[model samples]
Target chain A: MQRIAVIDYGMGNLRSVSKAIECVADNAEVLVTSDAKLISTADRIVCPGQGAAADCMAALNDANLINTVQELIGTRPFLGICMGLQVLLTHSEENDGIDCMNVVPGQVKRFASPLLDTSGQRLKVPHMGWSPVAHSVAHPLWDNIADKARFYFAHSYYCAPDDQGSVVGQCEYGIEFAVAIAGQQLFACQFHPEKSAKDGLQLLRNFVAWNGKS
Target chain B: MGLAKRIIPCLDVDAGRVVKGVKFLDIRDAGDPVSVARGYNTAGADEITFLDITASSDNRDTMYHVVEQVASEVFIPLTVGGGIRAVSDVRRLLNAGADKVSINTAAVHNPELVQEASDKVGSQCIVVAIDSKCVSSPGEEPRWEIFTHGGRKPTGIDTIEWAVKMAEFGAGELLLTSMDRDGTKIGFDIGVTKAVSDAVEIPVIASGGVGELQHLVDGVNQGGADAVLAASIFHFGEYSIGEAKAFMQQQGIEVRL
Candidate 1:
């Protein structure tokens, strides 16, 4: 059976993410671990994170999994959720402009204060709740999930990828931003598929069966 | 805007079993928190809020188990509140798999617990639940007052002012409940809901007095709440989350449906 390792750096909601993957990957052995060896050998790696970018990076470094993650990126199927997606960017405006892994050539920018939608209504920061994601490129992970399907997002900062070709999905919250990106064996999303209900589970199931291909 | 407003089902659990009551009185069994949570997930609930109505020390363990069970079963964000007194309490629940922890009476008493809990565990996981009731003094313009102890005791603090203070204290979201309209089912106390939602920039979830689907619409359109939370209606199966979302969508409100 293919082993999927959910990298845990003592950040974010790891159990729910692992449980969601377990529910869908009936044939895979899903393990939530911070051990670099376990993560390095897994057939697929799922990196999930929440909270501040600086803190997430600090925790990842503290766990000594930073290099392990960058090494596994192209070797196996890798999925990132929320901060998982942000940390891959070059830098984040959060924590006063902290540096992140340069796996994806982009910078994370915070939404301007007092942000308003086109309707002139004030948009809430953190961008909590469900929002539609537009597909930018076809990939295996998008299978069984309809276009414009709503996904649960809870974050203030968003990614601005330098390579638009790598962007696979887009969402808007006061402004348009990339919500999902697909490159080589890497597929990450700004929304939490575990918290996104039925279509979300479908996405995870797709990831499990993807085989790290385009 | 771009984000869809949320329709959340609240599961008030006691001794690991779901319970429901009006204005925190005449409690009755609803179902198992885990199973009910699963039902809500399948019904297309935007999110689920599992509150341990009875927060006794003994029940704390029960609540933890319930949260763990529900979180494993359902794939939506889970907000667990009640009896959360300290940062350690918040950590315990989060470790048990809750996405957010809602603080009520404890936050009212210390106030700083809001800041501490938010800072210690990140603000996004901290939701301050304010139970407010309208107070009408003779010849004076009636104003809503903050109430603690499940709306049984009055805090005498101005509801709007307290809400603003909580937000300043690092509360990511405000779960605003109206004591007067809680069980009346007339609808959310729009006056208080608008008062709090407008006062703070953080997302506000309007709770209490949701009798039907229209109430949910009124919560977002009239009260301007970022999300709407109801317990009895969902617990008794009077309105599925789908029905509520469909009705809200028809009313021109953006919902998960």
Candidate 2:
């Protein structure tokens, strides 16, 4: 059976992500592990995270998985979710400016305070709930998913890729921010596909079927 | 387009079984939590909230099992509330596949629990549930106070102040319920809902007394709530989540339909 390893760095819950992938990938052996050997051997790597950026980076270093993650990013089909996407960037402004993996050349920014919509209503921080994500490029992950499809979101910071071309999906709260980013053999999102119902499930199905081509 | 206002269907679970009671009384069996959640997921609910009304520790395990089963198949954001007193409880629910855990009475008694839990598990997963009731008299400046023990005991904390403090304490969201209109079905207490929503930077979910679809719209447009939650109207099949979303959309409020 094909093997998919979900990197576990002792951050948030990995069950939902693994369970969601399991629900769709019938033939893949979905393993949640921090074992470097296991991850190196997997067909796909999914890195999911929650909580503070500094803490997440610290955890990655403490678990000795930073090198493992750096090695696996472009070698195989890799997917990142939420803080997982943030930590891949150059650096984050959260926790008084924390350095990240620098795998993706971008800065993570916090949503400006007192953010307002067109109607002059103050948009809440954390930007919680479902928002429509507009695709910026045609890729395999966007297959079967509609343009501007709503996905679940829960975060205060967003990714701002230095190379705008890396952005594959954009979502607007107070400002239009990059919610999905992609490169050769890799795709990541700021929202949790595992928790986002139907369209989310379709995205996972696409990820499973993808063969690391653009 | 921007963030769409959320429509959440709340299921009150007691000892692993889904139950609905009017004003916390006249209890009746609704159905199994997992099946009901699955049905809501198909009907286009933005998220699901399971409030465990079970009072004993022995019965709490059932809530965990119910959350796990529902979360495994439903695939939407699931929030489990009630009887969450410590950081461990939050971890337990998150381990069970719940996306978030709402803290109510425990938050009021030991406000530090909110900070500790948020610090331990990201603030994104910490939700502080507030049950507030109007304390103002007619023809007076509107005021409200937090209530505990199912809105029977007042905690003397000002509603707006508590909301701001919770946000400062790292609460990612607030589930604000109006005790005065909880079971009345007249509508939400737009005054208090708006008060708390405007006072806090985090998203607030306006709950209680949603008798019709228009009430859901009012919760967003008028109350300024990022999300609206209701029980009876959905539990008894009065209006489907899709219909509610359609009505809200007609009223020019963005929804996930």
Question: Where does candidate 1 stray beyond 4 Å?
Answer: B21-30, B138-142
Which one wins on TM-score? 2
Candidate 2, residues B1-257, lDDT tens digits: the string is 77889989898899998876323222233467877887788888999999999989999999889988887888999999999989989989998889999999999999999999998778999999999999999999999999999999998999999999999999999999999999899999999999998898999999989998889888888898999999998877778787898899999998898
Cα lDDT tens digits for candidate 1, A20-83: 9999989999999999999988999999987889889999999998898888899989999999
Q: Best-fitting candidate, measured by lDDT?
A: 2
TM-score of every prediction relative to native: 0.95, 0.97
| lDDT values for all models | 0.88, 0.91
The TM-score between candidate 2 and the true structure equals 0.97
Going through the candidates in order, what is the number of backbone clashes in each? 0, 0
> Which residue pairs overlap in candidate 2's backbone?
none
Provide all candidates' interface root-mean-square deviations. 1.4, 1.0
